[model samples]
Every structure is written in structure tokens, then in C-alpha cells.
Target: MCILVLNRASMTNEQYQSARLSRDSRFDGVFFVAVKTTGIFCRPICPANPPKEQNVEYFTNAHMALEAGYRPCLRCRPESAPNSWAWLGAETSFRRALTLIEQGALNQSSCEELSDRLGISSRYLRQLFKTHLGVSPKKYAQYHQLMFAKQLLHHSMLSISDIGFACGFNSTRRFNDAFKKTLNLTPSQLRRHGLDKEARNVVYLAYRGAYDWQSLLSFYQKRAINGIEKVTDTSYERYVEISGSLAWFKIFADHEGKQTVKIEFEMEDVTKLSTLLTTIRRVFDLDTDITAVESHLNGINHELIVHSGLRLPGVWSTWEAGVRAVLGQQVSVKAAIGQLNLLSESLDYRVSGQLVFPTPGVVSNADLSFLRMPQSRKDTLARLASHLREHCDDSPNNWLALKGIGPWTVNYALMRGQSEPDLFLSSDLIVKKIPKN
Candidate 1:
């Protein structure tokens, strides 16, 4: 069993009681309240009557509650709670392991393989999981898969078998067995009771706190690639390619009151759903704790924090971000996008009403006579592309070894591509002038 480690700064038992009593949406995913009387756990914002404080115990995460033998509350649907990982206070390895697990690292591979990727021994990896999360990495991965499936079961019109396969269960029997054994509820039963019958190919992803939809949308609107990405006043839609499969998705902000963003998606490969959802969450910065982030930023310098709930809007992939950054060097946003349009028009692949960004291989070999830029800049773009193609490495830190890939280009790619949070654009001309003011 996981030991409860409470500190003054962390959410105390009284705080949990208060938040659940008031049904605070901000604390929805921060912790779970497991009611011993009901033998179930629920999100803090559950609409069901709050259990008596004496009968409830707080678990820092849904996994801990589940492991403690508490089934998820069907009414509250704990699976749909916002997935903010920052508050876990875990080190990089544990966090990376969780990311890998979400990407199905343990679905078809062994724990040894996972530890190998992390450059650690399997024993050490297990130790890490036990110490922090109080469960083996395998158990954590399995719980997440089931949670994702539960989310789909409640929100999507996908068939039971399809949801099973989509969530990485090899067969329907296995999925059903695991679902029943762990959640104490059958998938069919949950679907019958909880599913939104009207939903079709739609999944609502949750988030906590204020969201500056206009600010993030405006940022994307300025740089959206035509035919690939489209930004509207109330929604953002894009054609996406993940793990060699193509899909299209649109996200609407109108689900504001529910504390979730509505995602209407169409994809042929159901198995890729988990990865696609993870990508969507990261790209939209859905998993960030805005309250904590804003508080930290305000402490830095109040003036530096311009907008509330402004998230780090991410590009599709690191490769795409690197290409955009190279094109944007020392240029206005308009100029950079113009060059990008020219480049995309020249080399991008088109199907139906959509266009796929040019691959590193395509950009590396392309002649730059069409782009109206200095020859040196064109050469730099080609060099960066060639390096990425040859090495298959997208990390900005690795890109620093290349010429013309300076701090600004690397930082831009890290910020927009990888959604890295701790970046200081001190080299930027505008940022450099901030101290003068």
C-alpha cells in the first residue's frame, strides 16, 4: 500500500475535505477521495453526494485509490478527470516512464525493455515506481490503459470490442476480464449505464483552471499552415499523422463549463487512439496545472505574465518545429509563415483537402530556388534538415552541434516542438530589451 506523505505545502486532509465539499473543479485531478463505505473512489468534483469525511480517505492519484481496492465511482467517472502530471513531484525518469507507458511501452514490450530505454536496470526502475507511486510500473501502465478505456466507453460511440483493442488490450476477453477484475464493473455494464448515446467519434479531454482560449488560438492562427491546420474563433482543427497513420481532429472550447475540451476526431487505425489522444493533450497543453504555473510565474515578475491560462501551444512534432524555427530565424512572423507556405507548396504531400508537412528527407534534398530568402539561410535550413534525417534525433540539445542552429532556433524548437516549459529566450532581441524598460 502507498504511504500517505503529507506536508504543509501539499494538500492536507482538511484541504481535501474542503475541496470535495465545495466540489472545486481546480482540485478535480489533484487527488481522489475514496469512500470506504461505498468501496469507491471519485474525482473531487463528482456530482454525487459527498461521503462523510470520516468515511473518506484521500489518495494523491486515481492509481493509488484503485490499488487500495477502491473501484472508480461510475457516477463521477474518475477516468474523465483532468490529467495534470506536474503535481506528482516526480523526477525525470519516473515522469518519462509514465509517458512511455502511455505510449504503450508495456503493452507489447517487457519492463526490462522499458528500463533499458531509460538507461536504468529493471530493478532500479521497479524500485522507483514502488518508492513514489507504490505500485510496479506494469500495474501503473495497466491502470492507465483501463482509465483511458473507461473515458472512451463513457464518451465515445465506439463498440466494446473496438474500445478494448483501442486501449491496447489484445482481445475482448482480456479487456473484459481486466476491466471487471480491477474496476469491479464490466465494460458493457458501464457502457449501458454511462455512455453518451449521441456522441460519435467524439472524446472530451478534461483540464483544470482558467483557459485563455483566445490567446492560444491567436498564437496558432498567426502561424497555422493552410490546408494542414485551421483555426476558427471557437475551435481548432488539423490533419494529423501519427505513427504512420493519418487522422483529422477538431477541438471546441464550448465545453468550458464541464472543464473539458470537446474533441471530434476521425481516424482509421483504432489502435493509435491512445497515442493520438496523448499527442492532442500535449499539443493543446491540456495536462498543465494552470493555478500552480500562474502562481510560479507571478512570483518571477508580475509583468512577465501577460495572460492568464496562456498555455505553451505546441507544434505537431519536433521535426516540424525545427523546420519552422529555421525558416523563422530573424524574420517577422508574417515573413516566416510566407516562406513556410512557399516551402510547403513546393514539397508538401497533398491528399483530399489536406497537406502533410514536408519530411526531413524531402526538405534535406530540396533545391531552395523557390524560396525568396538569402542563400545562406536556405543552406542552413537544408543542413538542419539533413542532420535530422541522418541522425533521427529531434532533441534541441542534440541540434546545437549543427551550424546556424543557434540558441534561439534550439529554444524555439524546444518550446513549440517538445512543449518544454523551462526556457528563457534571453537571446531574442525583444526579450533582451525587456530589462531596459
Candidate 2:
């Protein structure tokens, strides 16, 4: 029953005008409208007086608007807009390239290196970005970094220098220069206009549409790994490992609205912020296009429409998902948790009260005689661990070839592990029991 709008880049002039006039929240990130008179671009939901059709120009993204010489509206903070899910266009290479860009791909390497990693030429990669996003990969990455820096300025207590480095800027001077060049304001001036002083190491993330918090919490609760993760009625807590250091973070929904989630962490290294935020977005499926998902599910089941915001929860890592899937085969959820908890307790690494899941090397080398599972399952686990350790660049096809991993397990892992939306478990007993039309 959800009304699906056309992709932002494809929206007609009239459609953009209508959305802007009405101040529609659904169109917040879809496209931004730049007022020629004011020389500022604002999210569709901005409360400012609407500009006349002649003075307003629609931009597919904030980057495009910036390229057109329009400054971001301070009142609307286009930087705070939920990411446009439509940016993940139809091309596989485009999506993968975008993902890499979000992970600070250009900060560490050139476009040629990135293209080499994606198995495409640098020219073709540039073409993909220009064709779909209307900007080069470098521009997209730069815009994203600036946006993240802006978010930190408005939300965190980090100093301007720290915020710059945290957002992937190589030097404080460069960060200040970029801010002044792009927004006509210094970092400190922007921070002065931010919300109340934030507690150290906390950031808020925005998402579009109505998020089914209870459903998402329940999903994590059912699969919560002892010593590694915990799900409470109000928050989810987990231990995270980065650069050989272990830290904990907690996530809870904002009580004021369903549009944002708060992430509180105790990480000492600010440079890991980009990687951590990317993982959080993936784990929560914050970028899903709920309207498109509902339209696709409309013919199959009416109930699915009612619960369209129920996201596909993702794991912290593919290795964790695969290991959990292997442990869960043929066992009840509770039984699998018991075994997993025991395995974690037996592992070598421990921080606070939490245990880092054993690495592939550790799992493959450790003795499994203590586990109560069958010998065949134990052997399968060993083989999987060894395979993962040896083949660091293994694909899903390689995963499918491993012993004791069936189609169901592989599909389940892909769905949660890689955030693949199209994989459905039609053979699941619960899915099979659903009434047919």
C-alpha cells in the first residue's frame, strides 16, 4: 500500500515541484531543490518559503547542487538528509563502486586502483559514476567526507582538528579550507550552531521511512550471540574489533522519532569512524528503499506491506555470519546459541566480559573435542575455518563449495552477511506455511 516514487534522478520537473511545494518528508533525500534567488539548495522538507517554479532547479544529489554553485541551506542541512537509496542504481559495478567510495576508498587509493579491484578499467568506472550519479567518483567521495565532517561538527564534542582527521582529511588546514570553500563557513563556526554538546564518542545516524524498531530488535534478540552481542528491550550492545583493538558500542533508537538511531562507542582511534559508520549502516540496513520493497511485496502478501520497514538484519562480518550459520544447521535457535556461547568461552581472546569470536586461524587450529556437536559437523567447521584462512578473497561460490554448507546456509549467510536483498528462503518451513493466493 506504500506509494512508490520514481527514482530521484528520473523525477520530472512537475513531480519535483509538487514534492517541494508540499514539503514532503518522503522526498527529503530523493532530490534537493536549489533556489536561484537565494543561491542555496534545500531538502524538499525544508520549512522555508517555497520558491517559484522559475527560480527553483532540481538536483539529483547535493553534490550536483554544489557543482551548480548552490550552497547547502543552513536551515535544512542537506548534510543531515538520509542517504538517497536510489543512488544504488541498477548496475552491479556502480553499487560496488559506491560502497567502496563510502568506505573511504579514494582516501587511500587512486581511481585506477579502485577500478582494478572492481575488475573494470578506470575509464569505465568513471563512466558508471557519470552515467548514474552525475558526478565523478572523486567528487562523490569528497562530498561524502565533507558531509560526515559536518555531522561530527554538529553532533560530537570532538575538536575541529579531530573531526577533520576522523572524517579522512589528511591535514587540519585542508579540512578548514574545504569547509570554507564549500560552505562559506569555518568548522568552529558551524559547530557553534549545532545541537547541545554531545557526550564524547556518540553520533546519530538518520534513515528514511518508518523504521520497525521492535521488529528489528526482536530479530537481533533471537540471534544474539553471548559474550559477543547482547540485545536489551531498549538497546543493542556489541563488542567490535578494529586494527587489533577491541571496543564496545551500543545502539538505541531515538525516543523523539523513528527516523534516527544513536550510536555510542568508546573507540580510542578516531580514524576508524568511517569504517565503523559504514558497518553500522550495513548492519541496520538503513539505506533500504522501503517503498520499492513494499511495491514488490504487494502481489505476494498483504501482511508484508504492513511490515515493510522490517529490515534484513546483517552481521558484523561475513565470517561471523558463516560461522553462525554452520553452528545453526539442524538445531533450534536456543540450542545453537548454547553451543556458540560455549565456543566463545573456550576462545583465547577476552576483553572486559566479552570474548572476540575466534579468528579463522584460531578456529582451524583449536581442538574441538570439547564441543558436544557431532563429529561430522565438527569436521565441517574445521574445514570451513581452514578454507577461510587460506583463501582470503573467497567468493560466495567458493563458500558454496565448502563441506556441510548447503544452499540454504549459503543463502542465509549472503542475505545477512553481505546485505543481499534479493535472496529469499522460499524453502524455509515458516515461509512454506504462508497461505497462497
Candidate 3:
């Protein structure tokens, strides 16, 4: 029953009817405007004929309209929201469940463990899924598996077995069965490259909408982690490490038609595709409705976005995000970057023109030689990194509680790394102080 109190912009009858009459970019993702007469819900930007004035009703989201029994609009395809990221939106328990599944949680654990982590019961979790996503959590996980397998078949020359293992399959039979169950085509049938094809060695991760190409590039280029991440004409290339293994990624915007961002990946560990893609999405904040976001910020009194929306900064990797947060405890970005460069040169692993992030094992095992600073600060950051290494599971709560890492650090890392939108750094000293009324 959670709902977001979105901004209510004063609109003219023309604008309102235009939005209701034909869903257009102005109202996109702002609200789920339902026509009482037609019994259908659509994005503000639907191109269909406008409904009668008296027949229109606006709900905060499609979820809300759906709860009230309105069916999705067929013409606009409201379900295919480009802004699934919903900038600065609330994070519901269902979203948390989806994130966990993307992290390989369902594959390794169960519904019980998921509920425990979210601080809810298994029954409650199931109820939430039924109410929100309309499918059981397991079914969603199955859909996710099929997606991974499909991507491999289309993008890489990996055998069905390699794709299966990379996507968390126990056996080729299970992978094949699951692929067939969700998509009628067998894994081999739908492959873009058949067996014995030369490896393209490239995979593209689809991000939902258009981006500020120059802005996104400039931000990373300035603070681009030395060897680990590099900016190219088409992408921002980087080294990614998951579960102690290494991978390579090239992230860029697809300028073909409307506009979309893409991640071109090259890796040997195919089983980690699901987790990798999920993490990448979270890190980059894809699935956002760019049309809706620009409107909301533009509507904010005094234009707070003008000051801060200079760039949509995304976390390159969780480990790197955490490390930066730790170093930046009370220091400026310049100061933090300086220290991390030293730390990077001293401890990080270098291969294939990408500097690998210093792993938890290294932080826990070695003394803080490069992290030289106040003894207390040194001990604090090391302890946090060590905790990650020892537990081998970097949960949100545990990640936040580390010393020198307050809500600011945790919020920055999570927003960048987990795509958690509700995390607004209201207390950031540099941010204009709006009284917390």
C-alpha cells in the first residue's frame, strides 16, 4: 500500500487534455492517468486519442491504478516504462525482492532467507509479490534465467553448457528445460551465433533510456579510476570483479533511434551474467524515465537540479564505490581521489589494460600501508573492507554500519551501486540547505 507523493504541477486544460488525449512526453511517468469511462491506465505520454475530461483520474503510479482494478493501456504500452528506474522514487519491499533475485540470491538461497533479510515473513513476501508484480518470486527468477541464457546465445559463442553455468545452472538439462519453459525456442534455436561461430566476445546490456552523453562521459573521465576504467568514443570501459573473479565491460549510450545506453561486456565467467547485469543496472541507474525526471526537476522550486544534476553519476563497481566512500568520509572528492590513487597504485591488480579493484582479501590480510592517514581512520576503513571479506556477503545494513561511513557514504554507494532511488543526501553540506520541515 506504499505510495509516493509526487509533485503536482499546475497544468492548463490544454496540457491536461493533451496528456489524457494522447499520452505525450510531458506527462511520461509522472502519474498513471486512468480514464474512468474506458477503464484503462496509461502513461501521460500515450499517443492515443484523448478521453473525456470528466472521465479522467490520475494515480501516482501504474501500481496504484492496477491496485484500483484498472487494466494496462494497450496503445501506450504503459508496462514498457522506460523509466522503471523512477528517479528519487521510494524503494518498496517488492523492489528489494527483485534486487535480491538479480544478485543470485534465489539461486543460492530461498524465500525464507530473502524474507529474513527484508525483515518480513515468507508469507508476507509472497503476498507482496502477488499484489505488486503479479507473479511469484520464483517465476520472476525463472524469467531472469531465461533472459541471461538468451543474451549469451545472441551475443557470445559460449556453448550452452558454459552459458548455463555462468547463469547459475546446476546442469545443462535444467538450463535447457528452463529456457524452453519460458521461451518456446530451445537455447540453440534462438542463438544469434550458432555453434562453431567466431566469438564476437562482446555483449550489450540494455539500459532503458537516453542519457547526456557528454555529461556522463565528462564525470567519469575526470575521476575515472586509473587503469580499471577507461572512456572510449562509444563506451566507458572498465574492469569488473564478481565473487573473486575478473571480467571486462564497456558501457556506452546507443544513439541509434530514440536513445538508450548499452554495456558491451567481455568475460569468460558466463554463470555470473545475471548478478553482473543486475549490479550493473543498479550501479548505472538504468530503467529511468528521462522524460519524467527532467520535468520533475524543472518543476522543483528554485531549481535544485540545476546545481546538482550536472551529471548522472553511476557507481562503476560496488567495491570501488565502497572504497571511495571510505576514503571520502569527511574529505572532499579531490582529497579522496588522491588517496585512492595512491592506494590503487600500491595494492590493485593490473591486467588487460584494466586495474582490478583491491579485493577484500587484500584489505583483510594486509596492514594499511597505502591507506596512511589518522590511525583511527586507517583502522576504520580497513575494518570495513575486512568485514566484507570475512562475511563474503556485503549486505546493505552491514555495509552502512562501518566506521567513518555514515548515511552520506552509504547512500551515495547504494544509489550508485544498487539503483536505490529514495536515497537523497539531504544532509550533504555542499547541497543547498532546505529546511527539513
Candidate 4:
């Protein structure tokens, strides 16, 4: 194929230099530069040739990039980037704690469980948040609950009572009291409960920053399990299982104003809605502070661009991600990925219209050979998943006691599923074996 070339338009001096050099993708979600002359902000990895220096300016996010007079690049489509910061964001514990709190870890949970998840005492988790974020963990969690309630308030046409339940409040009276105290407004005042609106099933979700929607969508599209999920032009849908129940949710991105991306969700299983929303955010890596995360990670490995936008790719079910991890224990990434797909389709539950990965309870009793799985590894996956399904709720430290599941699987699941931030799998020998070149 013949190559075609285009002239440079406008970009910052530094950005033009970085683009020329193909610098890291860690800056994918951090900042974009809207060329004063051309009107496009791009991820560091954008393929367009370097623009004229001094014509560009940097922005904190894609939204900010647009607000500062630049449009999004068509090729890079910087919208759907996976969680931008590849670790290295500061105050790791705080972010991890924030993730857990958002997951409803504190809605009906005590400080001890939250603290234990952080591998710290309840006292320490509280002190850490107090010292850095100027709030207690419980108070922080309460703030999150209110913000979540605000999402339902602004998006869903559900009644204030339903909003309270969806946001994890135990009772409508409690929801009312908390709503008034937090927002100085009744939930009714915040809701959009018109008959027409509810008929369309519109519910808008609000978050703090401009997410790279295109970047995120593209990544998930490749890894999306065929029948289990959908990634459309306007929305994303997937499965989540929580507390012995399963549910499906769709996040629709319809409008944008101010600094927020409005996402609307429609859930099929109302009973686990609280947990479902929390998990969806984690699985999609929505609650992350992309700007801060991108900046810190970029500061470390300036050339980690290709892998910088690489997200932790949270899993919907612990048992499922764990088994995938186990099958990959001694294999290359490609081999592991292919084998995982085969295993899922071969033996997982599929009658639900969509193929739902069989839960721990359902698969624990399964015969390994039926999965066409390796004979040696069959019992290991079955038992480990079973142990987690049974003891994931046991008091602190039971994770370490599981027979075939070690730090790799446990930490991976906790970090991916529970959104535990500091749970790093840093010491795996196989991981260390990758050539440092």
C-alpha cells in the first residue's frame, strides 16, 4: 500500500515533540491538547503526525479538551479508554478504599470489613481517610450513597422510595431523612418521574470527570464475551452477580453538559440493584480519577503508551475471573485467552438467552472433565471457586487459607471485583519472568 502524508496543523510544542516520538499512552486519559488552529484534542497515542509547536494547549480531560475549544479526534476516538492510570496513582489506599466504599462496602457493612479489605484495621482506614481526604470512611461512604441517590434522582423515573432502595438505603423513611439532610431537597424534587420519561426508561448517571468513552468502548468490545454482553453506539450492557443473585444492566450515554458524562442504567433484577450498580462501575472502571491517575502513571514510564491505557479489566464474577486466572497460570497470554473462551462456552450456563458464567454454587458440584478442562486442573478450579463462594464472607484472613487459590487469584479477584486498590500482585514469579527489555 502506498503511504499518504498530511501537513501539521497545530499542537503544543511539547505535545508535538511527544507525538513525534510516540511517547507513552499513560497520558491517554490525563490531558488532551485542543489545537487553537485546528480544533482536535488527541490521546498521546494518536497516529496523526506532529502538529506545529506552540499552536496546542493541554486540557485535563476529553470534556475539558472540548470545552477549551477542541473537538475529539475521529481516528483515536479518545472516548472509551480503559482506566487510564496503570497504577501509580498516589494515595493508593485512599483510591482503593473509595472504590470499595462505592461498591456498597459500607452501606450495610461495618468499618472492620472495609478495613480488612484494605488489609488495615478499621481504625487505620478511618485515620488514613481523615488525614488525607478530611473525612471518615463511613462519612465518605455516606457521601457516596447520597451521590448515587443523586444519580437515580436525576436519571431514573423511579419514585423516591425506589431511589432509596436502588441506592442501598434500607427504608424509605431513612432515605427521605438522608436526602433532605444531604441535598437540602426532597428526593421528589430531584427526580424526573413523568409518565413519559418512565415509559422511555431513562435514568441518567453522573460522574466527576470526562471519561474517554470511545477508548473504553473499543477495549471492551474486543474482550466482550459474545452472548453475555453488548456494546452499542449509544450504550454498554453486561451481567453482574451479587449476594446470591444475578442481574443485568445497561449504561446509556445520551447527553453531555457541564463537566459530567450522563449515563443511564436499566436493571432487570431490582433486588440486587444496589450491588449491581456498584459492580458495573468497577467493571467498567468508571469511578477512577482518570486525570490524576493518568498524570502519575505517565510520570513513571513515559513509553508505556501501548500498555498505559491497558486497564486492570475488572471481572463481573470472582469465581469466573479466578478460573480464567487459574487456566492461565502456566501459559502465555494469548493461549490463556483462547483457552478461557473455550472453557466458558463449553461448560458454563447458557440457557439464560445470554451465556452466564456458572456461579460458584452451580459449578462447585460440576465434574471437571465435563468442561473439557485439563484433568489435573479440574479439581483445583472447582475447589478454589467453591471455597471462595463459601468463605468470601468469612472474617479477615480466610483468603490466605484457601488451598489451591493463593495470592494471585485472591488478590486479583479482590482488586478486580471488590475494587480493592492496594491489592497488588507484585511478586508473582511468572510476572517477573517477562523480559524487561
Candidate 5:
């Protein structure tokens, strides 16, 4: 496939060249540099000596580079680059499709099935991928699967067979053949050496731009559910349920001043690894392009944004977020957290020595009379849980139709649950109380 160069939507090729020359971390995942002489692609932050501008070409994303017949540079490890929304353009359908693919939509299903989920034809979906990303949707999905498997091989202590299964390969032989054919490297050859000293459950997630971990951590610490979550000086830990089993995941911000954070998770059903990682990314707001956000905010008013690396601190799921918002209504953060703990303790169960949050089904059937909250709030929680169970949709708009749910609850769910970027809290007391200067 012929490669598509940098379009008007993205930065100019000269800017990209300058970024590669300076090894700018901000452009790490925004664009990839492929060397025509060597037939290899590398992240802009790759440490190798820069290739002459005449000999290098730029692709919008790693998939595009791979589709252009360039093997990934082993030194830069393009597989571990931060996932970027910059590469996903303004096409809402395409963006949604990409999100679904990352969440393992194509793992056990076909592109037609994926498009069916999006209410579009498979052919148009392929055209969207081709127009925006310079590759077919299937190729993009396969690239992600392979890249994720490579990342696991180089970082995690998972065995090769387990990695294959986790990445959606049915067997070891198929995994090996596909790995060798695509990446031109055997799984064993790509696995990092000296694994004995590494944390078996640990993997580093890279990000671009400044990340205000302290601020985000403090926000979580103040409102954290005591038994379900633990926020400390340098890390955030929480118990989560994955694939019907109890699991716990933690993020450590001690990257020694690097633009990456380490995550450690332990769970059953390794096949659900992709789903777990997707949730972790959302919870941390990893996919945000903070530079763009800051630029836009700065244009509106320089004083509007206070922190350098501000991000949306998202909840694990819409259901959990809805419950939290319902319990938090007309109460202090401390009181809301207490109610959350009470609800979890009453309905939650323990497995593998970790506590898992109560599911919607559990909350729907239980009479939450033990909590020190108003009856109306309890009814709202029940109605929300029942709506979730019956409709199988988590859109915030749908919640507005339910009784006892209002704009605040829906907006809270949208802001925290989905990490929506644009929201104006005119009805908030604090927002309204601010002096009109």
C-alpha cells in the first residue's frame, strides 16, 4: 500500500522532522518516522542517530508505518508508544470503531460483526480506515494484537503460550508463525532477557506531555472508597472485577521523572487482559492529548487552566460512576465515600483474597436500608441499576429518562465515567459563586 503523508489535520512534515531531530517525547505517538534506506520505522523519541530528512518519511500512526512496508525499530520499540487520539481524526464513527477494536472487538469477531455493532457497513468502515489511517481495519486490528503481544513479551513475565492466548491467538504455533511473518522476529527472540529480577505483574505504560500525578492522586485519595481502593503517596490501587472474576490493579507513578508510569495487575482469565488494560487507560486518562487541550483553554483564557498536565480522572465504569454519583448527591465527599464502602461491604464478595465491587445485579436486588442515606437516593440507585440491567446501554442520555435522575447525575457520569472533554458546570454552586471578573 502506498503511504499517505502528513495531512493538513496534523503537523507539517518539517515540524515532524524537527521533533525527531530533537527527540521530543510529545510527538512520540503522534507520528512515526520511517527510514527509506533501512525500511524501518521508529518513534520520534527514538534514541538512535537521526536519519537525514531526505531519507525519512512520516506516517500518522504506527499502523500506517507498518502498512507502508517498514519493520519497527527494535531500539525504539514502537509497540510500547503511548496510544494517541491525535491519530484518530474528527470522524466520530472511526474514533468509536478504533476504541472498540482496542477493547478487543475484533479478537473473536469479524470486521462485519464490528461494523454491525457500530450500525455501519463493513465496506464503509474499511474505507474510513483507509482514508484516515492508510490501512484496512483488519490490518489495524492485527497490528494492535501483534504490538500488544510484543509488549507483553518484552515487559511482563507471562509465558509465551499465555501471551499468545491473551492476545487472541488460539495456539502457540499460529502465534509463532504470525509473529515471525509480520514482525520478522520469533516470540522467544523478542522476549526480554533477565526476567528473574523484574516484577512478574508489572508493565510500564508510556504517555506524552506533563502528567500531574500529585493532583490526580490527591483527588482520588479524598474520595476513595476505603475497602475497595487505596491511594498512597506514589501510587493508586483498586480492586476490580474482570471477566466474572476478582482482580486488582495498581499504578505506580515513580518513573524517576520519565514520561511513563508502571502498572501492576493480578487477575484470573488472562484472556481478558485487553479489557483490563483498556479500563486502566481510561481510568488514568492516558489517551488525552493534553497539549491540544491546554492550547485551546489558553486561547479562551490563560488563567482558566491552572495545572500543566491536568487530566480527567475517570471512574472504572458508567455503572460504578452512576452509583457513586447517586450516593454522593447532597452530601460531603467523606459521607459519599462512607456510603460507597457500606454498599460494597453489604453486597460485595471476596475471591482470590481480593475484594470485588458489587455488580449491578447485586445492587438491584438488595434493599440498601443499612446506609445512612435518604430513601429517594436509594430508589434512584435501584432504578439506575435496573435500567442498566434491562437496557444493556450505558449512555448518559438514556439515564435522563429514568425517574430521580437529573442533569447533575447525568453530567457527573459523563465527566467522570466517560472522561468527556467538554463540559460546563454552570449549575454548580462553586462555579456559580466564582466572582465575575
Candidate 6:
């Protein structure tokens, strides 16, 4: 029943052995080691003695290991390992499907509905997951929810009921049943042996390698919307709307040994926790494979090598990013901030001293003539809003088809809105300044 899901050639047995022997944190989530003798899977950094190579099997993800009948190791707590940023195969559809799943697409929707959103058949989608991940979509989703709940149990002070709802279970009874069935332990039992202190409204998100926090914070400082976002030297704070609830969250790097960013939030609705975490992970590019990205850029240029950890900061919402991109065209960053602040002030949705940006419907129907911008730009904003309101699609090509959005604007929107990593702004004035040897 063991599924050798990951491509074996990606890492040789010797490398995995070395990593496990040395208890290297770098390979913690890249691949899990399942011991045949003990029927348990562990993170690479597990403190237990290294199992004999012949007794070992590797999996690309925790779900695969679980499918092979290996229970998670309690010593290492594989649930807390940083996620593997590497995609298993070269299939773009698989990657997109994985992203959507991480965003809770499967929480309340069928595989068919997810397939429809991905523009593929359910059969093909299931096949793709099996081929690359060695599990069905439903199983994968279930594992993710359980793992998240486990992490919450270990890391947070939240009640078991709150954790269950946050992880997408229907009720406390169901959550308890799931915990008992899956882990052979009740939720309270797990909480009694939790690792961290009972910190309220806090979560630690992990990322591999050194994060260029200054670069990301500076980028956000320039484009920060008034009353919505604020960036300081060591922290970034923002008011976010999730499922109609307004909450403020702050993120700062954990200066301790763990390579993680700590996020703290104030909110009443616990169900939105999963969505909020996903959005924060995307916005910070936490899942980027820094090693691969650095290797790809190595020898390309000296500058690229110097700042290899520079991440493409993403926004909370596509509509917000699109609107900001439109306002930023042909204007200085400072001017764009001023304009956005003005727009926020004029909007009607105010909550907790923060003004929520207008929705596309409101912008499309409103008379934006008072904003002191040129008539052409105003008309373009209206048209963009209307187009966005009419269609839920947020692709770059779709934005490009609009009247005023050109390559730069489209690419900017894609980079920030969609968290696209490979995009480059060739036409950027700063990029143009780089000398071509």
C-alpha cells in the first residue's frame, strides 16, 4: 500500500540520509521519512534515531505518507513543519488546483464544482491529484483540515470548538469524532499535551530561507492605503475584510530560531481563520521555493544573486490590487497613495476607524468625477470596475483587454493580485536602468 509519490530522483537516498542524520531543518517539509519498522512518518528533523535506509520510504507530502498507512510521529510533529514549496510535477493544472484547494475551495464545494472553476473535468482533476499527489481530492482536503486542526491544537489557545470551525468542520461533535477516528485521541487530550503557550489570536507561519523583510515592508510602505494598511520598520499592520467581517492583523518576523513570521489578529468570527491564514501566506509568498528561485537566478546577474530572497508581495484581494494598479498608472507612488486615500475617504463603508474600499459594483455605478483625476482615467476606472463586476475572472489577459490597462498595469496586477512569481516588468523605468552587458 506504500505509494512512492515523489520523484525519487529529485533527492537521492544519500542526501535524505544525511539530512535526517544531521537533523537539518532545511529539509523538514521537503520530504517525509516513513519508517517501515515502526509504521510512523516523521519530519526530516525528527529527533529519533535514523532508521535503516532499507526501512525507509519517502513521500512528497504528509497525505501520501498517511495513505501508505503511516501515522504521524508525535516526537517531531510533522504538522508543524514548513510546507514544501516545490511543485511535484510540471502540470500547470495541478499547481492551480493545489492553490485553490489551499484556499478552501473544497470546504463547501464538490470536486465537480472545483473542476468547473479550474475549467477541467472532475475525472481529470482526480487523475491529476492521484498522479502527482497520490491521493484523491477529497482525501487530500480532509488531511489538510485535520493537519490544520492539529497545528491549532498544538500552537493556539483557541477552544476545541473554535479550532474545529476554523478548520472547516460542521460542528464540535463532528470535530471530536474526526479527531478520535483519525488520531485515536480526543481533542482535549491533544490539547493537554500541546507545545506552545495559550496565545490568543496568534499563528506562526513558516517560510524557508532568509526573508527580505525590509524590501517587502518598504514596498508596502510606498503603496499603503490610508486607514487600511500601515508599515513600520519591523512590522506591517492592515485592516482586512474576510467574509464580510472586518479585522486588523499584524505580521512581524519571529527573531527566534524558527524561520517564521508571527501573525496576530483581532476578530470575532473564528471560521474565517483559515481563509485569513491562506491570504497571509500568499501575500508574503511564504511557500516560494527560495532555493530553486535562487538557483535559477544564479549567474544571471550580480544583483539578482545579492537579493535572492526578494519576494513579490501580494495583495489581499484581486479587486483591490486592480484598482490600485489603475490609480498608480502614470503617477508617482506618493501621488497614487494620496489618490487612494481620497477615494477611501469618499467611500461609504467605514468600520472600526477603517474605510473598506468600494466594491466593483459601487465603483461601476458611481460618478467618480469629483476625484480631480483626468476624465480619461476616470472613465477607464469606471469601465474596469464594470468589467470586473460583470465577470469574476481576474486573469491578466482579461484585465489587458480593458481600455486603459496596458502591459505594465496588467503585469503589476498579476504580480500583486495573483502572486505570480515568474512575471517581469521589462518596461519598468527602473528595470530599463539596468545595464545590458
Structural similarity to truth (TM-score) of each candidate: 0.93, 0.93, 0.71, 0.61, 0.94, 0.92
- Candidate RMSDs in Å, in order, are 3.2, 2.4, 7.1, 11.0, 3.3, 3.4
True-structure lDDT of candidate 1: 0.85
In candidate 5, the residue pairs with backbone N, CA or C atoms under 3 Å apart (3 or more residues apart, or in different chains) clash, namely none
Q: Which scores better on lDDT, 3 or 6?
A: 6
Worst 10 residues of 3 by lDDT: 1-10
325-387: candidate 4 lDDT, tens digit per residue = 677666666666666666667666753355676666666776667544466667777777678
lDDT digits (tens) for residues 189-243 of candidate 3: 7663333264355455433334566676766777777777787655677777766
Model 2 over residues 1-437: C-alpha lDDT tens digits?
12347565566787888888888777778889999998999998899888899998888778889878788887878887877676555688888888888888888799999999899999999999898768899988888888888888877778889889887889999999988898888988888887546457778877877778888898889888777788988789888776566677899865468478888877667777888888898999887767566766786776667665778889987777888878878787888878887887887566444577777788999998888899888888888889989974466557877778888778877888888887888766667788986
Better of 5 and 6 by TM-score: 5
Better of 3 and 5 by TM-score: 5
Q: Candidate order by TM-score, highest to lowest?
A: 5, 1, 2, 6, 3, 4
Higher-lDDT candidate of 2 and 3: 2
Kindly report which residue stretches of model 2 are placed more than 4 angstroms away from their true locations once superposed.
1-3, 299-303, 306-308, 351-354, 433-437
What is the overall TM-score of model 2 with all chains considered together? Answer: 0.93
| Candidate 3, backbone clash total | 12
Provide the overall lDDT of each model, using Cα atoms, as 2-decimal numbers: 0.85, 0.81, 0.65, 0.59, 0.82, 0.80
What's the distance in Å from true for residue 212, model 5? 1.4
> lDDT-based ranking, best first?
1, 5, 2, 6, 3, 4
The residue-level lDDT of candidate 2 at 228 comes to: 78
- Clash totals, every prediction: 0, 0, 12, 18, 0, 0
Query: Could you tell me which residue pairs clash in candidate 1?
Result: none
TM-score of 1: 0.93
Worst 10 residues of 6 by lDDT: 1-10
| Model 1 poorest 10 in a row by lDDT | 1-10
**Regions of model 3 farther than 4 Å from truth:** 1-91, 116-119, 155-157, 192-199, 208-210, 302-311, 317-319, 330-332, 349-355, 391-403, 424-429, 432-437
List where candidate 1 sits over 4 angstroms from the true fold.
Answer: 1-9, 86-88, 299-306, 350-354, 433-435
